[model samples]
Target: MSILTIHPKDEAQETALKTILDGFAVRYEIEPDETEYLMSSKANEIALDKSIKQAEEGDVVKIALDDLWK
Candidate 1:
């Protein structure tokens, strides 16, 4: 079993692909659209990289659970 990510070029293609998969009874899941968050631009990736670097450098600030709502 392997995971595959398919980015259909348009809605028509997406519908056609899903129909074919349904006809074959292949188990698959349609992930929630993340175009806005994940692929809208490169900002998300840059932010993620920055966070990773901060974590690696131990530059994160820790807060207690009790202080979270404060």
Candidate 2:
């Protein structure tokens, strides 16, 4: 289970990416949650401090489709 952070600004792009992911013919799930640690991380931190400030600290869960096939 890998955690992938989707920046709020690239939401549209993320959605598009998800669409592409769906084409992979794999079973996956998206769970929405919230967290504060993202507020202090630099990994894939595509938003600015001021923008992150307004980030309601949330998460979108993605499970590997390969696991479901097993």
Candidate 3:
């Protein structure tokens, strides 16, 4: 099992990663960054903190298309 930390800005990239990983049955989790920063409402720092903490516990993975071919 592994955890992949991806910036939400590149959502398309993440989707591509999911597809490649799915083919191989590689377990993974997505860690989302703070979203309230973009909103005008109150901050959601707690959610951001929790996501970061979850990421720290799992193994990190870098998604590369070349890896899929190997």
Candidate 4:
């Protein structure tokens, strides 16, 4: 199966597309807004950079695989 992302210009267009999909019984999921998603992704990148810096500076604890869930 493949996934398709559609960016409708407005609510009317979105509604129209959804109606057609509903009529055809096509399963679909509404995703987070693009702008909001991008903002969140940026925040994650920043956090990852900080974590990498800490690891380089020996600021992380080493946990054994078996102790990870303890």
Candidate 5:
């Protein structure tokens, strides 16, 4: 058996796909969002936590708006 993972653009698309699948009696499972994958592992969770803490403490430097691309 093969499985297909889908990333819908918006809620409407997600609902439409679910509706189609349901109409066809296909079994499907809903998983967590992208953020869940970001912190899926312990090391990743720690790194994200540290980054969030730094941002909350205002330890980040601000770059000029025009210099963003350069």
Candidate 6:
């Protein structure tokens, strides 16, 4: 089985999507946004906090602006 990730454009679309899923009797699961998803795990939250702190301390590497596509 394959999983599908959907982002509803607005409340109306979200409601419509739910209605369609229900009508088709398709099973679906709702997931939290990225930040909340990561925070769901203690280890993930700790790692994210460390990464943020390091960035604030300028501990990240500097990359060339023109090399983004490379």
Instruction: Evaluate all candidate structures by whole-model CA lDDT and list the values in order.
Output: 0.86, 0.61, 0.67, 0.88, 0.96, 0.94
Tens digit of lDDT per residue, candidate 2, span 34-68? 44555456753546554566654544345698886
TM-score-best of 1 and 5: 5
Worst 10 residues of 4 by lDDT: 34-43
Per-residue lDDT value at 27 in model 1: 82
Clashing pairs in 2: 33-59, 34-58
User: What TM-score goes with each of the models?
Assistant: 0.49, 0.31, 0.38, 0.47, 0.58, 0.55
Candidate 6: C-alpha lDDT = 0.94
For model 1, the superposed segments whose C-alpha errors exceed 4 Å read 1-21, 24-29, 32-40
TM-score of 2: 0.31
Candidate 5 vs candidate 6: the TM-score winner is: 5
Query: What is the TM-score of candidate 6?
Result: 0.55
By lDDT: ranked, best first: 5, 6, 4, 1, 3, 2
Clashes of each: 0, 2, 0, 0, 0, 0
Error of 4 at 63 (Å): 37
Summarize candidate 6's per-residue lDDT along 1-70 as a digit string, tens digits: 9889899999899999999999999999987888999899899999999999999999999889999779
lDDT of 5 by residue, 1-70 (tens): 9999999999999999999999999999999888899889999999999999999999998999999999
Score residue 65 of candidate 4 by CA lDDT: 100
The sequence of per-residue lDDT tens digits that candidate 1 reaches over residues 1-70 is: 8888899999999999999999999888887686456645688878877888999999999999999999
Worst 10 residues of 2 by lDDT: 31-40
Best by lDDT: 5
Candidate 3 lDDT at 26 equals: 83
* Distance from true location, Cα of 30 in model 3, Å: 1.0
- Model 5 residue runs over 4 Å out of place are 1-20, 26-31
* Poorly placed runs, candidate 4 (over 4 Å): 34-70
Better of 1 and 6 by lDDT: 6
Write candidate 4's Cα lDDT for 2-52 as tens digits: 988898999999999999999999999998885556557777768777888
